[model samples]
Target chain A: MNTAILSGRELNYQYNRSQRQPEGGKAALANLSFDLFPGQFLALLGPNGAGKSTLFALLTQLLRLQQGDILVDGTSIRQARSAALKSMGVVFQQSTLDPDLTVIQNLNYYAALHGMSSREARARSLVELERLQLGDAAGKKIRHLNGGHQRRVEIARALLHRPRLLLLDEATAGLDLETRANINRHVRDLCQQQGIAVLWATHLIDEVEAADQVMILHRGNKLAQNRCEELLLEHHCDRLIDLFGRLTGTQTGELTT
Target chain B: MNLATASYCFLGIFKRELHRFLQQRARFASALVRPLLWLLVFAAGFRAALGIAIIPPYETYITYEVYITPGLVGIILLFNSMQSSLSMVYDREMGSMKVLLTSPMPRSYLLLCKILSTSLVSLLQVYTFLLIAALFDIVMPASGYFWLLPAVLLASLMLCSLGLLLSILIKQLENFAGVMNFVVFPMFFLSSALYPLWRMRESSEFIYLVCLYNPFTHAVELIRFALYASLNLPALGVTAAVTAVLLFAAISAYQPRNRPQRGKPPS
Candidate 1:
């Protein structure tokens, strides 16, 4: 398989704090670079306002690239955005589902947006729902589902396109610890089983496992990128919590797991 | 985008809009009720007071209800277009618009599909109003029913484009209600929808001139002429020109380079 499914070089973005002062803006993302090979689970660790979502926005072409470029399987996101986006799927931090729409309808609509035929979309939707143990809930409206279930349905919808690269932004936000851990496991297993590269962005440190590749983003800059275990050892910390606290300038008070 | 993909995207968006329209019973009710009230109650009250002379389409003086039926249809189209724009604003706030923008299709195609879908729904609302108008004994030539479809479609596109342009100008969903009132009410009253330009000229030449300049006047005239089984060349020409210009502007507003940043952090 082609190893590097996604890569970015010198990605940069800045937002004007005040419209009147054009020069008075802070860099949201600065000179960041990263790569993800096929079947790898890469964790993007950042606190709030650390520019994790900004990077996702750049990758998804929701925000125009101010500088540099991103490539999906060697296809340039800037030069050929459509072709680059065709192989990727995204789960935003906020709920994007139509609350009035049934789960099946939502999945089919997304599949159609990805250019899948109705029959193929239905089949893939069923398979994805089954994978998420949501087959029976397919007929239910999204408003009726719990927060965790809704997120699962969103994941199913995202995967219906069979994207090789999955970009998830705070996918487990607002869920209980057990539900969050279960979702983390499910996505991790999806990475290994489907051989799809996953970039999971979150502020939670416990979600990162020892084997996953970790990229610590702080204030629009990449502080470190390495295997989670090696990073912990290099930082001289027993737990990722302490390491993350040190990097983000916050002290860990309580550990969940 | 390829033909197959384009067709799929169009169908998907169109179906979603249709389903949403169907599910919102209150929207459907209000959309129909507003125009019907104008035809039945407002026209009834004004029938004795206003006098419409021998219009070109009519050899004899016509009832006031018949005179304003075409205008009410215009009202339906105008309100529906603005309502759909409100949906676009709501979609942006709810994060669904992001999902739509991320599609692999060209941005122009996606936005066009969105505008066209809303136009299609507005067309349905137009026809429903017309059907109710006919049931009230305010009938037109049978051929007008068929020809009015294309006229309504064109008018809907023009009005939908105008709504989209306003949506782009007005940033927030919360502000949409105020904008809708300012735009929809003025456009409807300033045009020939409620009163003829000639009648307005009798009262105030300036308002008559304003009505002449209003694009909604041409839209209503286009449907009026089509309903009479005749073509109004100037109305058709102006409506088509306005549609092209506004559609271009709307598309430009939605382009990624022109898309405005919502909050401090990107999502």
Candidate 2:
């Protein structure tokens, strides 16, 4: 396989608060590193406060790097943020779409942010919305659309720039099961067909298929990383749910009651 | 920063803000109403109570309404600045701010674009107010109307920069109200908005000098001079310098994509 499309080395980040005692600052991410291969779908599994969102923020350049470095297609994020961002698409955990704007307008505005002309943006937006099965809702305001449709619009907006890598931070959190499955299938197909790398952050282990790579993060540290099947077998757990419990040291049987 | 890219970023943000204004029609109406109420009701009530003094910009005794037009303009700019900052906080909470800040453009250029967009909206509101003022026979000289544009632009820059800085420093929307009560009121009141600096000088030279140093005072003075078809170099210089400083401070405080530190989480 070609070199990883995105990689981070010794990424360390600590929250600095002047009002806190000298030692009170929290280390959100500590000496963590990973590489995402081209065309591979990698799911990051972690519990709440496991630094999943923090890592996403750092990767997307929302937060400055306090230590270490990130590379996008071999260019350092610090040295070439614009070029790096150009190659990456991000769907944040929260909704970034304007509620007042129609689905098409939201996508067009995002395209403009990337410096694309209106004509080109409209053409691409139509194609992307069609591909996402949201063409019918193109003219509806985001506030009028259901959560699932709104999420699809966000996905369509992210792809308008045609980035080589896609970063999704809980992109399907509030969607219904059927809608979530459809989104996952579409994302999987996109990765396979376009040779795009994907890093999907989620707490649910079922979201990670047997064929895909899985990175287990616990308390800001990467505990294990491998194909889902290999990880399950190595832990002597036949099911992903059981394996997830073993890996994260959570009480597995308690939920059955 | 590349000037072309900066211009593009500026235009993009400007368009977004304009769209926001169109979407929030109620907000625009409310913004207009507050100033109109002051111009009509409050100015009418105070016109007889307040005595007038001949200032440099005014050759003859002017009505209280005419004297306070520049101050009311400053009020529009002030409120718009606070609204812009409030929206910035809302954007951050909603995550759209990340999309704008992460663009390849320099942080300062992005902020300047935000300021420009906000100021454009503020200027639109001010012109509308001026039109109404004209209907009421409070209009300045025709030449003064032309100078209003640049004066308004400078005042918008200064206030918007201050708002941008506040947005960066304030972690929560709740605290912004306190800032409004403390910062906005003092700046508006202590400045020569309601009275001339010379009037304040008779009471206390220190208050006069403080007013002289206030960027808002300079903003009002600049507009006052423009209202007479003249210029105020000191006011223009002070406003520009303060704008540059605040803009620089705001840009320097921006931290790419990194999440700002929220206060201590519950134990």
Candidate 3:
């Protein structure tokens, strides 16, 4: 088998007492492990408070790992943080784009952060922006664009460096149906065409396709890890939502009928 | 990374700050107006009550306006540094900070670049204030204007570091108002920015002691000396040492292990 581009080994994390508003020092994640190879899309399926974001935080180095190790393209994040971060691009759940700057301007700023030369930054920014169908709106301020377009700008920014891995933290949390599908299709196409490994986290069942790899998490524990169709076949369930309901013991509101 | 990459990163941050600063027209106007008011109104009103003395940095007896020019410059640096750091808190809440932290560079280096960018922004306002002071005939020695550049920049970096340390401690935007009242006021009022140490000693020995201990006092003294094309060794030593400590401390506060307790629940 080809070496996995992303490897998360026995990952564990817990919130401390001071961090607890009501529940303190509970395990936010427990002995979770996963791997993704190039051109693969792994849908991290979980509801609210299921430790999806906590795992994302740890993977992105936003939160330091309490226990376990994350290796991005063979570099341990703990041992070589800069090298580990260098191999991946991330789209945070919250909008990180500057609203006052134009869409292209935002891309250019991120290009600089990645240490890309001005010539390369402009060239890559245009390619990504056009691919995402954001070319015409390049000069428009971020505040002037709709929520979906802003998210697309963010995706374009993340891709400017052409990372081996792409991490999306609820990239479609709040969006119209058509926009969500458009983003979903775009990310999938990127994974296929560029051979980029994708770790997509979401609570929505529809976001997970039948052929995609899926990991079901509940209360910081992995309930299942397999292809969507395989998991459904193994559980004797007809739909992904039914399988999720059986595992997490809770119903999610974002299911697409 | 290489020097070319590092330099571009700095340029990117500088460009972004420049854009934001230019867009906020009121911010520049307000920064100047505060110091100008003190130089024109408060200094004029206090000239009759406060007598001038030939301080170490001053050659002879000087007017109240000349005496307090550096102090007004201190006020500008103090306020601007705090305001710039306050934006960090805003950025953290608004999520832009994550973008910065995620850069494929050392976290400490990224933060230093951030502080440097903001300090550069504050320096612009400082120079503007100095220019206006010069127009009002409150000019420094000829080379003093040039000398003030490095002196004020060092002073500005120290103040920005202290403000960044405070920003890490302060969790919410609502609580930053308390910093203005507590941190800014105490540093400005308890320093030689407004009165001489001897004069302060006459009023209360405790206040005098506090003024001597405050880092802002050393920063003001440094600026005062540099503006006259002279260097105060002791003041320079204190200001530089404190800046190193505060900057190191601020950078440590962002490191993964020491990062302020992030108990935010998973969304």
Best by TM-score: 3
DockQ of each: 0.62, 0.45, 0.63
In candidate 3 chain B, what residue range of length 10 has the lowest lDDT sum? Answer: B258-267
TM-score of the second chain in each model? 0.96, 0.92, 0.97
Sort by TM-score, top down from the best: 3, 1, 2
On residues A166-185, what C-alpha lDDT tens digit does candidate 2 reach at each position? 99888888777788889889
Q: Of the pair 1 and 3, which is ahead by lDDT?
A: 3
Chain A of candidate 3 gets a TM-score of 0.94
- Any runs in candidate 3 off by more than 4 Å, and if so which? A17-24, A252-257, B260-262
Which residue pairs collide, candidate 3? Answer: none
lDDT of 3 by residue, A150-219 (tens): 9999999999998989999889988998999999999999999889999998888888999999998888
How would you encode candidate 1's per-residue C-alpha lDDT over A58-91 as one tens digit per residue?
A: 8988887778889888878878888878888899
lDDT of all predictions, in order shown? 0.87, 0.83, 0.87
Q: Of the candidates shown, which would achieve the greatest DockQ relative to the real structure? A: 3
DockQ of 3: 0.63
**In angstroms, what RMSD does candidate 2 have relative to the true structure?**
2.7
Model 2: DockQ vs. true structure = 0.45
Ranked by DockQ, top first: 3, 1, 2
